[model samples]
Target chain A: MHDKTIAEISAGLQGRKFSSVEVTRAFLARISQFNEELNCFITVTEGEAIADARAADERIAHGTAGPLTGIPIGHKDIFCTRSIKTSCGSKMLDNFYSPYDATVVSRLQDSGMVMLGKLNMDEFAMGSSNETSYYGPVRNPWDLTAVPGGSSGGSAAAVAARLVPVSTGTDTGGSIRQPASFCGITGIKPTYGRVSRYGMIAFASSLDQGGPLSRTAEDAAMLLQAMAGFDPRDSTSVDHPVPDYRASLDDGVEGLTIGVPSEFFDQDLDSEIAALLETTIAEYQRQGANVKEVSLPNVGFSVPVYYVVAPAECSSNLSRFDGVRFGHRCEDPDDLLDLYTRSRGEGFGAEVKRRILMGTYALSAGYYDAYYLRAQKVRRLISQDFHNAFEQVDVLVAPTAPSVAFGIGEKTSDPVEMYLSDIFTIAVNLAGIPALSMPVGFVDGKPVGMQLIGNFFSEGRLLNVAHRYQGVTDWHLRCPNGFE
Target chain B: MDLSIEDVKKISALARIEIEQQDIDGYVRDLGGILGLVDQLNSAETDEVTPMAHPMDQVQRLRVDQVTEQDQRELFQSQAPQVEAGLYLVPKVIE
Candidate 1:
């Protein structure tokens, strides 16, 4: 039961092979057994899960079930779940419970998907690794000592461990894809305005977009089908038609034009990872796809531009937690300033504070033009690079991260080193293009992922490319030693 | 642009996050390092380029200015740290 994909589980439930209660209990039991070691979950709603499972079983009996009915799924802690602790891996919101559900949460719930619980993440979705999480870092199930790549590390870890068939994750930079690559799972970040952001805690609002992490591209497609589409509540939500993502999974790769960015294969990338990417592209070529070397010249400046833009937006977005309305508050205060400062100081973790300060400095009165506005101008150049490349190719392919998972304490001390982990993934977010990371191979017994990027509203094609490659490969099927 | 300890202090205050006096030096080093990396952007020739505020060039969607939410003040207040009657409580602003 634990080995089944979401599509398989949905079929089994409809065929009456097992009740949703039984499947939900199986996952809850697995979570209890392994959670202490991985720390993937921040809150496991056993009671609510059982109740929702029972309701799903009843719906199945009535023959009114959807494709995702009774499918157990996890939500990243960033999404607001009514009356549930939606801690964004921050002490500030550890005691906070939202009065409503995020649009993503309610949409999945309306499909009758059983919610397992909220997964852990980096504090306010700020870090490239789970080490910055207030709940503690999530260990990669592949190797217990290695760090699970983050912000959505818990979601990727849980899915990789088969605690859930699918889970929701948000990627501001590389949060979803990097962790998915580290944990050997499938994760995708749709176009920026493809999904609604209402009730989803803001972090670099311009770059943040929510998507799915699952065991296969097919599973991700099913999950994404339900999560995409416009919501009037979100001012930035794109008013576009959401296509049937699963409908294109079997679309062959014949004559598919793939762009291999020359900048993505620069000296900074590890040799072994580069070789593996070459082999993966070769496989795509064998399937009748034409590969061409393309240039994204301004993409080299992505990391610097991202640091400036993301922190600036984050500084403004995080100002809402000033300890006056909600979130953590100091025990006593001599004055309002003390209440504001002490509460925030005591509440946020180190990395979160660092980003807030960086953002504040960049957006400050004197430095705004040099830092924030200048970065935005460079951001346009980066997007233009992608636009130029897409003119010749249908999609772009690259390595998801520079390398496989690193040790827990490896890059935590040097913040710039930690920021470099997101080098390849950040430019996609900056351009608001759709990108997916799927397991390609392994290095030193750890998993590696290859990223596929497409133009805006091209999620279906990206899924098709990944799904077809998955059909010819078995890397996505390889479970961790202990996990199996 | 190197950050000084004084710059760190001012930035922390502006961001409304308190930094311990002992930690100011660490902030100076770390923030300076990050800014050093970001300074590479100065080399890019961005003349004649428009500063992109967002990925998509869409304007803010407007809805008719009417009440769209029900009264959930009590439910919202339930999560506040301190509340009296129907308002949030904070450190007194006026004497």
Candidate 2:
């Protein structure tokens, strides 16, 4: 049903053949019949997803279910679930809610999955495309006039419109592999403190991560093995050690190697994404990989050192959206600086007030040493050019963008053509590494991806080289055309 | 290098926000065509460059000033706009 996979819908709900309330009522009737032409949900939770699919069909009739118990997913409204409406899509959190949850939604509701809504993004997550969001621009379920790549463009258009088999996004820069390469799907991100950001919301906390947006790569390694581990309320999480991301799924690629960076195929790429990344690096050299080329020339200054370190850490994690606390305030405020300037000028939107005025003019005081200490020393020469190309490639590939899905508001009134569609995903979030994206081709008709990356807590060897290039590509089982 | 509308009204009053006067001539022509491509990172040449904040240059593990949350201050100021006893009310700023 909708081409199964999420370990075949958690082995059809652990073999009873069906039930998690009929797969969460067939994904809430395909998200109420295609989320109003793909605005890709801002809050759907259909009656708390049928009471969390009747409590995951009574925890698989008491066997105490697990491998994502009843599976359904979809989160990206910048985490924080609690009483639901966690609007990080912002009109200053439209109506707020969140009494708690986000430890990646209580570890995907402690692995019984099923939530089924929240999605839409890019406000505090600050743009790449989901047209700055404030709950609008999400479209690209493969070309309903393009433009999905974004602040996890509604979890890559609800896992490329199958509506949700796996979702949850995040990624600060290159907001989850440039909208899972303009909504073809698969996603990832991972590395930086691999997972736990307490309750998400804070955008650039040293480059926010939180992963998975799937269709495959073995369902983003089973939703990044239940949204990763370590969480002592995130002081940058990483206390490490949490493997088994579907450990080596058929680990093929004979001699591996693969790199190919030559400044990620230069001449400012996009010759149809450098000929579909040279035919997916010649199908990873006929599946035995070993490609090579490599070099990161300070990854051509990773988009001006990730726009001066993700807007100086999103202007200090959005000075706690001041309207004296909750979201969007100001009705009749005569003082307190007119209620924090008409509630952040009517709750931000315009690429979150141009990255909160280029992160308060690069942390003010005479432009913090010519733009935030020279974009943090060219972000340590772009992570010492990916620690000198992962000491000669074990993984790395590019074309995650530099063209494809350029229609909707064609470069939303140009913010440097939407920050050069995140120049090959801000040098893998400025080299904290572990990337992923997936789908391989399609140009005018949209989808493109490729990415992969790795190194530094190599997310289970980049999901075993994206599950052996999604086991010889069906372009992650193509879909999109008027939802079949 | 064009921005003036008094530098977009002094960076929209130091980003407290509120900009309109005919939307400042199309936001100073779309922020001077996106800061003329952010002034090509001002003559790229990160001068003997060093600026790479954190992608694991390590040294930031800290975890001892313990508290491990409990006062969910009435479930975090019940989304404050004016919470009472647990504080968070604004509009008097040093009388």
Candidate 3:
């Protein structure tokens, strides 16, 4: 029951093979059995989940169920859930319960999906490894010693472990795809503005996008279908028609041109991963897709550009967490400055503080142009590189990360080394394009992800490409030892 | 662009994050490392490129000016650390 995909579970619910309550209980049982080892969940709303499952059972009985009705899913803790603790994996928001649900959460609930609980993540969605999480690092289910790639580590870990059929994740840089890569699950970050960001905790507002992490592209499509659409509440939400993502999963990729960027295959990439990527491309060629070598000249600047832009935006966005309103506050403050400083210092983790400081420095009067403005201008060149590549191909394919998951605490000491984890995935965010990471193969018994990037508003096509690849490969089907 | 310990302190204060004095040196080293990395952007010739503040080309959507939310001050302030008289209580200014 736990191993079924969203589509399979939806069918089971429709055919009355099992009640939503039974399915939800199965997942809750799994959570109890394995959650301590992985730390994948921050909060398990067992009572609320059972109640929601009972309601879903009623909907299923009434024959008024939607495709996702009665399906169980988890939310990354970053999304606000009214009346539920929505900690963004920080001590600051440890006691914070939102007064309203994020648009993504409400949309999924309206689809009749049962909520399992909130998953853990990096503090304020700041780190590449779950090590920065206040709840403790989420262990990679495949190998408990290895760190699950993060920001959305808990989301990808839970989905990979089959604790849930699908879960929601937000990607500011490579939060969704990198973790999905490390955990051997499928995750997609839709085109920026494709999904509303209102009520979702802000982190680098320009790059953050909420999407789905699941076992397969087909399941991701079903989840994305419900989560994608416009909301007037989000000023940046694109007012575009939502496409039937599930309906387009079977669209063949024959004659589609897949761009292979030469820059992505540079000396910095691990040779073993690069060789695996070639074999993956060969499989695409066999499926009637043509591959061409393309160039993203400014691609080398992506990591640097991202560091400046993301931290600058985060610095401003996170300023709301002063002692006054919601979130943690220090005791016995001597003055307003003391209250602000101590409250924030005690609330935020090391990584979050580092980013806030970097942002503050970049945006300071004397350094603004040399750092912030320069990064933004170079950002356009990076976007133009994608534009040029897309003109020659239907989509771009690259490794999701340089390598598989590393041991916990290995890269945490060096912030730049940790930042390099998103090298292959950040440029997509810079261009506001849609990208998906699907398991392609493994290295040294650990999983590797191949990323597929498409032009703006091309999520359906990206899903189609991933769906066709998933149909031909069984990598996504492999489960970890203990979990299986 | 290497940051000094004083620079780290200034930035931390500007960001309103209190850094312990003992940790200032570590922050200076780490923050300096990050700045050094991002400094590579200085080499890129972006004179002809326009700054992209957002990923998409769309402008912010405008809506009619009307009150869409009902007064929920009590409910909203329920999560505050200190609330009195239906207002959030903070350190007094100009006392």
Candidate 4:
């Protein structure tokens, strides 16, 4: 039962082979055994899980259940779960519990899925490696010593280890795909306005879009069907109709024009991972998909552009934590200025503070044109590059990260090196298009991912290609040692 | 361009995040590297390109004004560190 896909489990649940509570208990039992070892979850809602599962069983018996009615899923700690600590993986919000549910949370609950609690993430969803988490780094289930690629690290790690079949994640510059790459799972970042950001604590508002990380593309489709939709509460959310993602999963990818970006296959790419991508492309070709080499000439500027843009937005977005309405407070204050400064200083971790300062410097009067405005222009060029490529092809393929997961402490010393780790995934965020990362093969006993990028609101097509590719490949099915 | 400790201090004050005396130098080094990386933006000829503030070319969605939400000030204030009567407590500002 633990090895089954979410689709299979849903069928079993509706067929009444077993109750939702029984499945929820089985996952809860797995959490007790593996959570301490992997540090995947921040909070495990044991009493709530059983209670929700019991309610789900009643709904299932009443025949008023949806496909995900009894399904068990966890949300990244960034989303607001009422009465649960919506920490956003930061010490500032460590004491905060949102009074309302994030749009994603309420929507999932409305779908009748049982909540297993919140998963860990990078502090305020800031870092590429999970090491910056206030809860402590989440170990990759594939290999304990390696860092799970982050902000969404724990969400990926938990699903990979089968603690849950699916979990929610956010991607602001590769938070979802990079960790999903490291943990060897399927994850997607819907278009900029696809998911609502109302109660999902803001990191970089323009770039932060929430999606799901699951064991297979099919499960991602099922989850996204529930998670995607316009919310009037989130002003930026697009007023587009939500399409049924599950209905399109089995659509074959024949005659699909796949664009392999020339810039992505650069000198900096790891050789073994490049070779694995070659094999993955061959499988796509075998399925009658055509591949062409396209160029994103301005792609080189993505890292620098993102660093400027994300931090500038972060500095502004994070200003709500001034120690007044919610979040952390200082011990004692000589004045109001002291209260604001000391509270924020003690609340935020080092990387967050660095970005905040960098942003303040960029958005400061003298440097605005040199940094923020200039980055926004270059960001337009990067988006233009994608706009051109997608004109000739239906989707673009690239490596999700430069390489497989790095050792936990390998690149923490140099901030630039850590920023470069997201070189491939950042451009998509800047472009505000949908992208998916699916496991292709293993390199150095760790998994590598092939990223499929689509034009805006093309999540269904991206999932179609991944589901088709996954049908012919076994990489998504293989479990790590000791976990099996 | 490298950021000096004084620059970092001023920026930290502007951002309203207090930096530890010992941590200032590290912020100087890290923020320096970040600035150095973003300096590449200067090389791009963005004079012809328009700055993109949002990913999609959309305006903020505005709706007709109405009373929509129930007052949940008490439930919302439950997590605050210092709430008294119905307001968040902070140190006195005026003499």
TM-scores of all predicted structures: 0.99, 0.38, 0.99, 0.99
Off by over 4 Å in 3: none
- Sort every candidate by DockQ, greatest first: 3, 1, 4, 2
User: What lDDT does model 4 reach?
Assistant: 0.92
Single out the weakest 10-residue window by summed lDDT for candidate 4 chain A: A1-10
Give the share of true interchain contacts found in each model.
0.85, 0.65, 0.95, 0.92
Query: How much is the lDDT of residue B78 in candidate 3?
Result: 94
Badly placed stretches (over 4 Å) of model 4 are: none
The alpha-carbon lDDT assigned to residue B22 of candidate 3 equals 85
lDDT of 2 at A13: 80
Provide the TM-score of chain B versus the true chain B for each model in turn. Answer: 0.94, 0.34, 0.92, 0.94
User: Would you list the clashing residue pairs of candidate 2?
Assistant: A376-B51, A376-B52, A377-B50, A377-B51, A378-B51, A379-B51, A379-B52, A380-B51, A380-B52
lDDT of 2 at A472: 74
**Between candidates 3 and 4, the lDDT winner:** 3
Off by over 4 Å in 1: none
Which lDDT tens digits does candidate 3 get at residues A80-133? 999999999999999999999999999999999999999999999999988999
DockQ of the two-chain complex in candidate 1: 0.88
